[model samples]
Structures are given as C-alpha cells and as structure tokens.
Target: MDNSTLVKPFKSINRWHMLGWLLVAQVMVAFIGRSLAPLGVLIGQDLALTKAQIGMLPAALFLGQSIASIPAGFIVDRIGSKRLLLYLSFGLGGAFMLMAISSNYFFVLLMVAIGGVGYGTMHPTSNKGILHWFQQKRGTAMGIKQMGVTLGSALSALLLLPLAAAWGWRMALLAACALLMATGVLAYRFYRDPPSAEPHEPERKISWSYLKESIGAMFRHKPLVLLSIAAMGLSGSQLILNTYIVLFAYEQLGLSLLLAGMLLVISEVSGSFGRVAWGIISDTIFKGQRLIVLVYIAALSIGIALMVTQLPEGISFWAIASVVAVFGFCISGFNGIWMNAATELVPFKQAGIASGFTLMVGSWGVIIGPPLFGYIVDLSGDFNYGWFFLSFVLLFVIVLLLWAKRLANKETQHNKGV
Candidate 1:
C-alpha cells in the first residue's frame, strides 16, 4: 500500500476514538489478567496457600505470557490486531470462568496460566494499533493506551475487593468473565485494522524459518537488546511492588483488607496519571528523548522503593499511602515510554515483532519477580527484604539504560559524520 492510502483511513476516523476503543480493550483484558493480585488474600485463605504459593499465581500468569508473546507478535502482525483481539477477549473470559469453577490450587494456577496467553498478546497488539493510528504525539498516545492497564487494575481493586468480600472470590471472578464476554462482543462489532495495516498473506506452510528470522532480527538489533534488558529489570520491580504492596500493607503495617485495597486503588490511580504525564514529558518536554525519561522514572522508583523499606514503626496511614502513590507513579510511568522507544528504534512494519520480543524478555521478570518476592517475605517474615531486592533490580535497570543511551548517542554522531 502507498503512504497516502495508509494515512487516509486515520485521517477519516477521529484518532481519539480509536485511542478510546483501544483503551477500553486494554482495560477489559487487564481486568481479567490482573484480578489475581487483588484476590490474593482471599485466595490464600480459602485455598490454604502460603505466601510463596500466592506469589506463584501471578508468576504462572506471566509464564503464560512469556511462552506466547513472541509467537503472538508474529501472529498479530500477519493476521491483524483486530482478529487477535477478538481471540484474546474470548480466551480471557474462558480462563476466568475456569478460575471461578476451580476448587484446587493447582487448578487455579492452571487456569491463570491459560489466561496468560491472553495477557501476552496485550502489549504487542496495543502498541501496533497505536503506531498505526497516531504518528504524532505517539508518546502521549502510548501513555493513554497504557493507562488502561492501571485503570483496569484500579477498577478491580475498587470493585472486586468489595464484591469478593461480600460474595466470595469465585463470584467476583465469574463477574469478570461476564464483563470480558461483553467486551468481546463490543470488540467484534467495532474493532478494525488500520487501512495501512493490511494483513500479511496467510502462510500455507508454517515453518521454523519464519520464527528464526523474526527472532534473529530482534536479537541483532543493538538498541532492542539493551532495551529488553532494561525492560526486564523494570518489569521485575513493577511486578514485585504490584503483587506485594497490598499484602505488605495488611500483614506488616496492620491495615484492614478494605484499607489495603484502597491503597492499591490509590497507587493505580496515581499510576494512571503518571503514565500520561510521563508520556507528555517524553513527547514534549524531553523532545522525544525517551531513554532519559525512562532513566529518571526508574531512578525515582528505586528511591521510593527504598523509602518503603525504611518506613518507621507505627507510621500513619496517609504517610504510607503517600509513599505508595509516588512509588506507583514512578514504577508505572516507564512502560509506555519504553514501548514507544522500542517502536521508534525499528521500522514500522517490524514494530509488532520488536515489541513482542522485548515484552517476551520482560515477561520473564514478571514470571520470576513476584514469586521470588513472596519467597523472600516467607523467609524473612516481612516485606523489607523484598523492597530492598526491588531497589537493587532498579539500580541494575539504570545501568543498562545508561549503556543504551551511550550507544544511541554514538549512533547519532556516526550518522552525522557520514
């Protein structure tokens, strides 16, 4: 397709409308995938699971993402994001329904793992859609799309906790399944691929060659390799905080479950704002210098995490809440920026594959971090060590980002010389 044909459809449609639907799609998918975090306490109590086991729940969900992300990216690029989104909606609903019916811990893990397949597709598909729809203000667009994740998590914390508190976790999960089904119907009715994003021809024969080529292209890209490493570290720390903060508040800080849930809601709400704010900073204030913004956010996250570890005994609720909000803001802000950075590093056609590979590497952090955090808590009898561990992880991320920045500068100077 010519550039004019590619640009025409976006011109006809209100880009904001496209962004809005994309946000809604992200919210619904995230709600299904992220429900486990809020339900941790109830699931633990009901199933007689240890802290470590509860951690494994999110791990399993991420493990599924890790397994499916790269392949899903290729599929999304070839089949178009709209078709994959429809499939994702159904997959999310089915997984949640299975979770609702499960009576055993193993069965619950199995269900969540299945749900991870849906979670795995989210980043690549959403990023691809946003790149197609918004050429300018891409960072801001990415932030808006990413806000769906925090909003979905916030909504779950606000609604599901109460619902589960009254009706039980199973009922809450069933309700989630129903919502996902509704989202699926809406997506089927409205979602469309950008006119420019014509689906690639269907492969008559699937082969290792295609996979090898796609994966090799990503690995050979220097910025992508560095960014993936940074993503891994940042993602690990984010998961640690998201998965453990509520438990930490309730168990270590002597807060009620309702209050803990409220803290989670506050964190997510702050994160929602931070995502947009950081995007604007990257797009405008930083003049598209995404790596600098990413480094700043990661450093800020490490500072906040360290602060969490140092909270005094008998600290006030507002005091703890403030720290959590800052932590949430900084930690949640970078993903959209990094994703935008990754997309900028590659050709438009390769956006899906690059994002998928980057996210696949990052998913390992999600898979391992939560369980490790929980295990550290199990051993130490507190969240202090867990918070400290995350700080160190962020420190590692900063190092990788700085290295990537230097490499980027070298490339820029070399092109100038040429």
Candidate 2:
C-alpha cells in the first residue's frame, strides 16, 4: 500500500513488457471498434443502407465512447487501470457478439454504439498505464501503445474483409468475438497496475461533487482546451479517411472490394509506423515540444488531403496505395503525441481526468465529421468534395495549433519570470 511496496514490484517488472501487453489490449479494443468499417460496402448493400447511414455507423460507435470517456477516465484514476481494461475487453467481446446476431440496420447500429462504451475507456486507461510505467520516455511509450490501434485497424482491414468476403459479415464478427474473449482472459492474467500508480482507496466513493470539481479543473486549463480543439480536427480527419476510403476506392475508383481493402491496409500499416516515428521525434528531436510537431504533422496531412482530391484516372493500385500511406502517416500518427501533450498540461494526479475531458470533447469531431463527409458525398455525387471538406477542417486546425503554441510559449515565459 505504501510507496516503497508499490515501487518494489515495478523494479522487477520490465516496462517494455508492460508496454507490450498494453499494446495488445489496445489492439483488441481497436479491432472490435473498427471491425465494422471494411464491411461497410457489404453491409450497406445487404441492408439497403445509404451513404449517410454508412457514415452514421462510426458516429454511433464514437458517440457511445464520447458519452463514457469522461466518466471512464475518472473511474480509471479511482479504481486503477487493469480491472477496467479487463472489463473493456469483455464489453467489446459482448458488443461484437451482438453484432454477429444483429438482424437489421438499427440492430447493427445499436450494437456498434454499445461497443463504443468499451472503446471510450481505451485512451485514458492505456495512457494512464503508460504514464505510470515510463516517465522518462513517455512520448515513445505512448506512441508504441498507440501503434496497437493502427495495427489492429490494418489487420482488420486485411484479414476481416477477406473473411467477410469469403464467409459473411456475421462470421467475421463472430471470429472477432473469439479473439476479444481471449484478449480479455489474457489481460486478466497478466495486466498489473504500475507500482507508481495511485492505489484505489475503498473508503472514498466517486461522487457528483468530485466529478464537478475534476471537470472544472480541466476546463480551467487553457492549453488542454486548445489541445482538445486540435485533437478534434485530427481525429475528425482520421475518422473521415478511415470510414470512407475503402468505399470511395470501391465505388469511385472502380476498384474491387479486395483491392479497396488493401488500400486501407496500406494506410493502417503506414499509420502504425507513423505513430512510433513521430513519437520518437517528439521525445528526442523536439524534446517534448508536442504541439510544434503536431502542427508539422497536421500540415503534412493537409497536403495529402489535397493530393487525394487530385488523383488522376487510370492510376495504378500501388500508386493509389502510396498516396494513402502518406495520408495515414500524417493524419493517424499524432494521437499519442496529442494525448502526451494534454497530460503534460496538468498534474499527474489530474492526468486521467484531463485525458478523459480532452477525449470526450474531441470525440465530437469523430461523431460529426464522418456523417458530414458522407452527407457531402450524397449531395455532390463526388468523394472529391469530401476530401476537400477535410482539407478545410485541417486548415482551421492549423490556426488552433498556432494559437496553442503561442499560449504555451507565454506560459513558459510567465513561469520563468515568476
């Protein structure tokens, strides 16, 4: 219970080992959440869903996460991360099981939305775990953990889509359920709270008064607010790309379903590398100057968005894949950096709540961006317009990033003067 006892076990346990398990946990959660994406075309065709509805599926999933994220963050701090991760794994498995049995469009929506409840806990809990274990290399640790997300997403696109094509979407969901159940059991067996993490005190109940104070504190932090805004744009762009890219390739470019899925796999694989590379850059070259690195990455993302809009006819598969890889590298890479930056803006004790608030608020972009992109496609009969719209969103994000950088600079100066 004391600090010495807490520090003892952590000395014996390798931090990298903890990071690997956390990565696996993240992959399981991301796979369950993103499993619905590559099947969008098939599911849309089977259920007579419109473009707008396909977009709404991810929205529903993120909406559930948005609702639960803040509360989950608070809970992680109070109860510790290991048990929450176990519950999340089981919750994701149950949600996928529901998806496998779903009979209609609404049923699928309901189940996917419910799955977000587990997805909501992912960022705060995993980041808390990383922060607890690796203070000296927090950015690198976060990036490595976040790679699980892109890796899971890539694997789902590569493997599950083919499984769906060969078998059925239901079978794919069932297979995912089996994997998730196994992940949950593994987490329960091996996941442990870091020796440095705050022990859960049984006497203190989480109450409304505590919730209000914690939230209030987060809002009072200006850098967190600005960082959350930037996160909104980043997440929005990433979600729009992930949710629609396969369908766009299939419908607009006249690619086969398999080919389209391969394009997505390319993006996810590049994104996995991007997360680690960018994290190392932030940790070493920038020396934890996260926002500066974020701005550079965001600008690169905008360039890719413009390129996506300008693809010529008769492009080769590898050519298109190359473009998508750049898009993934720029847009999907900065999430861990964003999370690392947000946590640094507050005290260690407040890290979970700050992360929860940032994620909860930033998730609105995930909620709104995809549906809006889909709606634009429905209106214009062109996916180019959707890409353009995302470019515009990134432009606004650049402004916010600049503003955040200014604020960060002023804060440093003020502290030095004090």
lDDT of 1 by residue, 1-418 (tens): 5767766765667778877878898998888788888889898889988888999998998888877777786787778777777888888789879887877889889988988988878878888888877769997898678778888888888888889999999898898888887887787678777766533545456478996898899899887789898898888777777777778888888888888888888888887778778988898989999888999998898888888888875678899999989988888667779888888777798897788788768778877888888888889887898888888888888888888888878887888899
Which prediction has the highest TM-score against the true structure?
A: 2
Steric clash pairs (candidate 1): none
Worst 10 residues of 1 by lDDT: 197-206
**Per-residue lDDT for 146 in model 2?**
71
TM-score, cand. 2 vs. native: 0.83
- Candidate 2 residue 370 Cα shift, in angstroms, is 0.8
Residue 324, model 1: lDDT of 89
Q: Which digits, one per residue and each the tens of the lDDT, describe model 2 over residues 337-414?
A: 998889887889999788778987788889989889999999999999999899899988888988988887888899
- C-alpha local distance difference test of each model: 0.83, 0.85
Q: What is the RMSD, in Å, between candidate 2 and the native fold over all Cα?
A: 4.0
